[model samples]
Structure formats: C-alpha cells, structure tokens
Target: MDRLHSDPGLLVCPDFTNECYCASCVPFISATITKEQAAESLCLVWVATNDDLCIQWCHQLAEETCISAKQAQAAAAAEATHLHQVHQLEEEMAKADKQKKNRFKHTNILMCPCPDTNEEEAFVSDFVLQKIDKGHFIEFYYWTNIGLEEALFSYSTRDDEGLIPSEQDGATVWISAVASKPSKQVVPDRFLSPVDFAQAVPRVVAALKEHDWPNQWVLMLARFWVAIMTHQYWNSNDQIAQQALMIYQEEQQRAWHNAVVLGNGAWDLSIISNTVLGRLFDHVLCES
Candidate 1:
C-alpha cells in the first residue's frame, strides 16, 4: 500500500486469474492472498476507481474474497444468528408456538457502549442473544434509526457456545426478544454524494486516530466500503465500474456486520465515524 499510495503510475489488475506479463509483477501479486490482505486490497480497488483501474479490480476482489465459500459462510452465519433470535421472539409474541414459547427464555442482553463518549449515558440499544438448539449461538445488536429499529450487527459463534464462559466485567440484563425497536432512536434517513464522501475521509480518519480507535488498513478499507455502500452514491455510466461498485457495497456491509457481531458489542458509532461509511452516516443520520 505504501508503494501503491506513493506511486500514482501503478496499475491494478482486477483479473487476478490472468497471467501477469509485466516484469515488475511481484510473486505475492499472483499468489492466493489471505482474507486480511484481500480485505485491504478490496478497499484499494474501490478508491482506485477514482483514477480508472478500480472497477474491475473491485469486482474481482469481491468475487475472490467476499464471495468465497468460507467468507460467505461466515457472513451467512452472522446474519442467520441475528435473524433466528428475532424470529423466535416474534413467534412468542404472536402466541404462534405455545409449547416452544414456554421453553427456557435463553435470551440474554449483552450490554453495549453508549451512543456518546460518556459511559454514564444509558446504553439504550438492545441486543438479542441466544444459544441455538444445535449447540451453537448467535448475537445481534438492535437499534432504532429513521423511525425504525434495525439490526446493527450479527455474529455467529465459530467455537462451542457451552465452552465459552460468561462475560465478567459488565452487567447482564434479561429482556424478551419481543421488546420494542424504537426504545432509543439514533439513526435518521441519511444520504451522501461521491464528492461529499471523498472530502470527509480525511477528517474522519483524523478523528479516529485521535480517539485511539482501531484504524488498521484492513479494517479501514472494509469499513469505508461499508459506509459508501450503506447509502446512495452518485451514479455512473461505466458497466464494469457499476458491477464492482455493487459487489464492494455488499461485501462491506457483511464485513461491518460481522466485525461488530464478533467484537461482542465493542463497536460503536464513534469508531464508525472514523471510517468512510462514518462520513456518510454523519451527513445522513446525525443532526448538524
């Protein structure tokens, strides 16, 4: 990235499957990269489109990394975990499943950070957490935005739910999944343009750095794509650019959702504000 950032003349080939005829091509360039590396590369391709090379590269990276069986599985599991608890609660509310409804209330509240910097501020957001009958578990965060409640994050356990011990530091609350969604509304209908987004990246990054947030290259790239895609973008006519744009958006949303889920409520909007998506959210969600 240091090399890519410094050298504007460099070209990124989205067709990683093709032969590299250039003599300057590095060995790692042709070899299969790790998921972490793929995540970072994915961001580069998206930003590189500001030049002319990113469209195909973004599409190819999304295909090779985010759509791979392992990555897709991870994303599916995360989303499924969030949905399961939600559905389970709905069934109970409707009195649809009487026998199962009486089953142990496995739901637990995993506490989360406050909307602002003060810990004393009530952590009004609610999360649905459950260990499935299959012996696995899923965790999801729920928050209100745009006058509606939406799932903020979803996580599926890669390890056994039974083996993992309870969290030691924070208080745990028990809430029925049937709880209302608009408890403490935060998000509002928001939108941004490509140019507006481009201008905000620097400020957001600076704020993140000052706050000592996790702004690692991979995390940053993934989050940036998530932010840009979470809202609308200025339209374009290039077919390749459009295709890659769509896939990156999908990949980033999954990445952000999974990261927050896996992080166990460690993620918050303050940290998100440092990302590319944070900038978009600021324009759309936060009041000036």
Candidate 2:
C-alpha cells in the first residue's frame, strides 16, 4: 500500500483517503485530464452529480471558464456574479445534509463519470479539428423545452443567409458558452447503450465523411453528444460505474469540477435584426 501510494503517477483524492473509496482507479486520471482540457467534457460531469457536488464542482469549473472566456471574450466572462450566486447556494445544500461527513464516501463515489475514456475527439475528424479551434467550437446553441415545430423551425432556418434565428419560438434558447447552466436538452436524455454505441460507430463515421452540414460544427456537437450518451449509460449501469469509481479512488488524490455549460439569460433580439442573416431571414420568412 505504501509503495502504491509512493507511485508518482497516482492521484488519490483527499476525500478518498483512508479506505474511503479505493486506490485502483489510476487510469481514470487520464480521463479526468481530458475532461479538464475540453469544456464539453466538463459540462457532462457537472450535470451528472448531485446538488452539493454541483455547487462545489461548478465553482472550480467557473474559474476555468472565466479564464478561457476572458481570453476569447467567450460569453462566460460576464457571469461572475452568477457564479458567486451558485457558490452561495452551496451553503444551503450543505446545511440540508446534516450527516455530511458520514455520507461523504458514497457521495464522492457518484460524483465523477465512469472512468473509461470514450474520447470525443476520436469521433471527430482531423478536417474538422484543423478548421475549428477549441475556443471557437467549444460552445454553440441549444434550445430548452422546445416543441417539435420550434425544432423544425430552427433547423429549417439554418440555411437563410441573413437572419440569425433564435433556437426556439417562445422558449429560451441557450448558448453553452456560459459557466453555471446545464446542458440538459443539448446532451440528449437518452443515449445509445454499449451495444448501440458500437453499432452506431460506423454511422457516426459516415456522417463525418458525407454530411453536408458544417463539418467542424457538426463534429463538435457529435463529440459532446456521444460523451454524454456514454456517460449516461455508465451512470445508470452499477457494475461499470462502481468499478470505475473504485479504480479511480484507490490511486490518486481526486478533485471534482462541474462542467455544466451555463448560459447568460440576457436576450438580444437585435443581433438577428442587424446581421446579414437577419436580412436573409426577412427575405425568406417575411418577404417571401
């Protein structure tokens, strides 16, 4: 045990020390590394945890997001106050759980996604990566509680040159660039099972080669979608999730972060009113 603890490669979370979780999940270190690199991966783990972890993890992620957003002027930069508010909510959640110390072991176990690496980058193409920098493609648009008509409307208007269409008719359309929001709908509720993921791999590959959609954009969306899908399955299947948690906890010091994509609820309809896409939308939907 001492020799394993001495290993430089291992990372045992403070929460998992003293036989709390385990010491074998060293491999999950790499998985956690990848999550840190990509905003989308962070978002997946953020949404998967309970409220207490969500608040704790989100603060760490928000700091990262704030740094990245400032560099790129990404939308998350403006949400500092919002992040603070979330942090404040933590006290409330913490107070609610009176037996916090006793529950820490089990709670920590469920916080992280399954340790296996289902690299989103693998599902994307080099062509897409070469064209889209991580900063630009990290965030995109998604709608909340949208009806079928709104979904169709958003998709149908994508081709119009001037009108920057809102993602939904009456509901909120979220931009994932912010730090405190959840990607509930964007990350599909239902994901492909293990068997289905294997079977669908070929089809996802074919889409990379054949789809006329903006190659890089589609690829970005696909990666996040697939990550969440696989994670969803892992979260539900006790055997895999438990194995992953055990292996990860045994070897390294663990820290949790929420990668839930947040949105700045500020709406600006004028963006569509002024842009060329807006004019194009006028021609197609209004003038036509």
Candidate 3:
C-alpha cells in the first residue's frame, strides 16, 4: 500500500492510510484519475464511471475553477462539509436494521423535470429534491421527506479506498425505491428525463474524439442510464432528489477549458452543442 500510494512504509501514517493492499483488489485507486491518463484495462469501466467530457471537466475544474486559490479552498471546504455530514448519517443508518438502510455512494447527478412542487402528492421527484437539499452539505432546489435523496448532499457510503464503483453495495448496504408511475405511465419521476439522458451523449462522443477515455461509451452510457432508472422504483421523498441543471452546464464549460489546455480544440462548445451533441443523442437514442 505504501509503495502504491507513495506513502511511508512504517514511519508515518497519513490520514488516508487505511486503504487495502490485496492483489485481489480491483484497481479502484485509478478511479479518481482522469480518462486521458488511466490504463486501457479500465477503459470500459472508465466510461461506466464517467465518459471523456465529464472527466475533462473534473480535471479542468481542478485548475480552471480556481480563481486566486481561495475559491478552490472554499470548494474543498464545501466538499468536506458535505462528506462529513454524509459520514455522520451513514454511521447512523448502518446501525439500523438491514432492511431499512441505504448505501449512498459515488457522485452521480440528476436534475428536476416536474413542473410543480408545493403539493403533497405532486410528484416524487420534488419530494426527493426537498429531502436531499435539506442536508447541511446539499443545497438543492426542492422539498424532501426521507433521507434517500439526502444521500449525495450528506456523503454517507462514498470515498472508500480500493472499492469498485457501481450501484451494488459490497458490505452492509442500503437500497431505496421511489414511486414514479403516474396513471400507469412511467414518466420522469424524481430523476432525469429521457431527453436529459441524451444531453450527456455529445459530451461523451466529443470526449472520445478529443481524448481517449479509459472505457467504452456504450457500457458506460448503459450503466449510467441504469443508475438513473433506479430512481423510478417505489415511493420515498425523504431521500436524495435530482441535482441542478446549472451543475451540468458548468461541467460543459470546464470541458471547453480543458480542450484549450490540451490543444484539442477540435471539440468546442458550439460543436458539441450544435453538431456533435445533437447528432450523438440521435445516434444513442436510435440504438436504444
């Protein structure tokens, strides 16, 4: 572990020293790395986690989002606050009976699709939104009840070292469901809409054209959709709701900044928004 993470063998113990070192462990350390530099073995997985555009945005955010370094510190502080609250809640939930817990992990996002939110039975998405935003770290735009949507804003079962990213939980886990069937029609409940799902496609294709991601787009997109689709099950508003649309737009801007830095100017905002993204959406939807 020391050799892998560049830490002291037996002299000093860093705060993140609890990571596993077994050979059977999957290379999840590279999960935090960008698609451009990760090994090819993680290619399909890299996409399953995040395609090119999102990875580029995350990397660019490390630098471009910083203005005089103080804002960067603030972002870290914000993330830390979010993580701390999530940890506290996770500890609380893990103590509960197995049938009534949730293992909120990873950094997947969704946005609002419902029109109204004040009514009690308006739509489950609004309920999820409300629940998640109520957390100390989450600043969402809806009202909530259950702690389900609060998963991301609170930060419970995420950031485990040497752990593979997926919807499944390995150890003591928590699964949740929300009802979304309106008049027997499976509509966009508390998660992203079908159109919104297609919105991220151009970003992926552009990432493939400009930078080689560590994974295949097909598997990644499939897994991504599956995760979102999970929100359609059951009825629980006390959980995590969808994320804000502004966050994704910010993601696209960061990708543009990364393209400039890497000299991959062939992929640009106008191109992705107009030609690439529109066409990519058509391509993926046609296959679906």
- Give each model's whole-structure lDDT: 0.38, 0.35, 0.36
**In candidate 2, what are the lDDT values of residues 1-288, reduced to their tens digit?**
111112222322233222333332233347445422343343344445444454555566677688886877645554776787888898768865754566554332221123223333223322222223222221111211232223344334545524322333366544222111223344221222344333333344344334444444344434433443344324665444423322222111111101211332222211211243234334444433
> Per-candidate TM vs. native?
0.21, 0.17, 0.17
Using lDDT as the yardstick, the better of models 1 and 3 is 1
Better of 2 and 3 by lDDT: 3
- Per-residue lDDT tens digits of candidate 1, residues 1-288? 211223333544354333442222333344576444554565566556646534444555666675597888998999999899899899877764654476446322212212233322212222222221111211111212211123222112212222323332365544424232232433211222343333333333333334344445334543544454443332545433333443334344455556665765433322333355344334443333
In terms of TM-score, which candidate is stronger, 1 or 2? 1
- Cα error, candidate 2, residue 208 (Å): 4.8
Candidate 3: deviation at residue 188, Å?
15
For every model in order, what is the number of clashing pairs? 2, 27, 31
Regions more than 4 Å wrong, model 1: 1-124, 128-144, 147-170, 179-223, 226-234, 237-244, 252-288
- Is 1 or 2 the stronger prediction by lDDT? 1
How many collisions between residues are there in candidate 1? 2
List where candidate 2 sits over 4 angstroms from the true fold: 1-192, 229-236, 239-288
When summed lDDT is taken over every stretch of 10 residues in candidate 3, the lowest stretch is: 135-144
By descending lDDT, how would the candidates be arranged? 1, 3, 2
> Backbone clash tally for model 2?
27
**Best lDDT among the predictions, by candidate number:** 1
